[model samples]
Target: MSSSEPRPESGPTVPSVLTWGTWAAVVLVAAQLVLGILMLSGSWSLIEAHAGLGYAGTLAAVLAAVSAVVWKRRGGSAGVMAHAVAMPVLMIIQIGLGSAGVKWVHVVLGVLILIGLIGLPMSLRSARRQSL
Candidate 1:
């Protein structure tokens, strides 16, 4: 460990947790969207499953956000951290809207959350590359 020697790069710390968590959240949101469509078409039986998956998706989003914070502490981008943190917040609001019977707003917010989840991995990758 001489001063003149280059240290080994700690590439993309927490990539698996952050990236996979985001992907899981994305998949859950997509499934929820399908369930929502079915419910709108009068398939009320799927509502319980939809509600269950919403909580799971929110948990996954929270995991992603926490991992992003860990990544930032390990020298990742602040922007990426902020982006990851937004997902769970959006999920909570979306859940509230759904619980309050505000169908239209809930659906729109769900779509936006899905879009954000889809973008999370790309942001993580970009931050990793920048760090390297």
Candidate 2:
């Protein structure tokens, strides 16, 4: 630990890319929710846009899960792995509920998914901060 030596930088890496993907998914979901709320207000219309964004969130969730696998394989952290993996599963269920027109289920799943999506990134940050 000499003054001339460089300190290990804290930044994004291959595994950490999962966090980025999670963030993207979270943004997409949040946008869709906002648009839906506006639609309900009778002041806006974005049903098509909201439906389309669902696919993007799904894709991001898949990437996030893959990233979690990479993190685990690289011996990063197992603590947050389950949360990372759950993102896509939750999204898939949400998609089904939406498609089936199960409004109650769809709404509940959306809330749950949003919670998990938001939590996944936080857990990622925590994992990074608590280096294994």
Candidate 3:
């Protein structure tokens, strides 16, 4: 605690690279949810063209989840781990609903996924702060 010793930093620390990457994935997943809802409601037939978009979002989420796992292993954040798990499961549920011809399920899941996506970053911040 002496001045000659290393001082504790003040203010909030910047998020880690993995944290930022995870946030980006969450944003993309939110976008995917919106697009999926539009597609299911027949408001957007461009779904076919954007099929790869969902896949890309899924891949990003998977990568984010993997990053979260690594971060958690390094004693990072529980929020990150939860985000990693929730997002992929939600993505799978969305896919299953779409395939089952259950448009309403897709719609509901889309909204829920969007909520979860937005929550991910907040949760990460909260977790990091609490851990610190």
Q: Which candidate ranks first by lDDT, i.e. highest? A: 1
- Reference-based TM-score of each model: 0.87, 0.82, 0.72
TM-score attained by model 3: 0.72
Query: What ordering of candidates by TM-score runs from best to worst?
Result: 1, 2, 3
RMSD per prediction, one decimal?
3.4, 3.9, 4.2
- Expressed as tens digits, the lDDT of each residue in 10-126 for candidate 1 is 434545888888999999989999999999999999999999999999999999899889878876678888999999999999999999999899988988888888888888777
**Which candidate would rank higher by TM-score, 1 or 3?**
1
Runs of candidate 1 exceeding 4 Å displacement? 1-14
lDDT of 2 at 96: 82
> Which has the higher TM-score value, candidate number 2 or candidate number 3?
2
On a 0 to 100 scale, what is the lDDT of residue 17 in model 2? Answer: 72
lDDT of 3 by residue, 7-124 (tens): 3543233247556666776667666666765666776776754455556666766776777777677666665687767787787777778668787877787677767767777777
Lowest summed-lDDT stretch of 10 residues in model 2?
5-14
Query: For candidate 2, lDDT tens digit of each residue in 45-118?
Result: 57678778888988998998888887777665676777778788888888888778886777767877888788
Counting clashing residue pairs in each candidate, in order, gives 0, 0, 0
Pick by TM-score: which candidate is best?
1
Error of 3 at 50 (Å): 4.4
The local distance difference test score of each candidate is: 0.86, 0.76, 0.67
Summing lDDT over every window of 10 consecutive residues in candidate 1, give the lowest-scoring window.
Answer: 3-12
Error of 3 at 63 (Å): 1.0
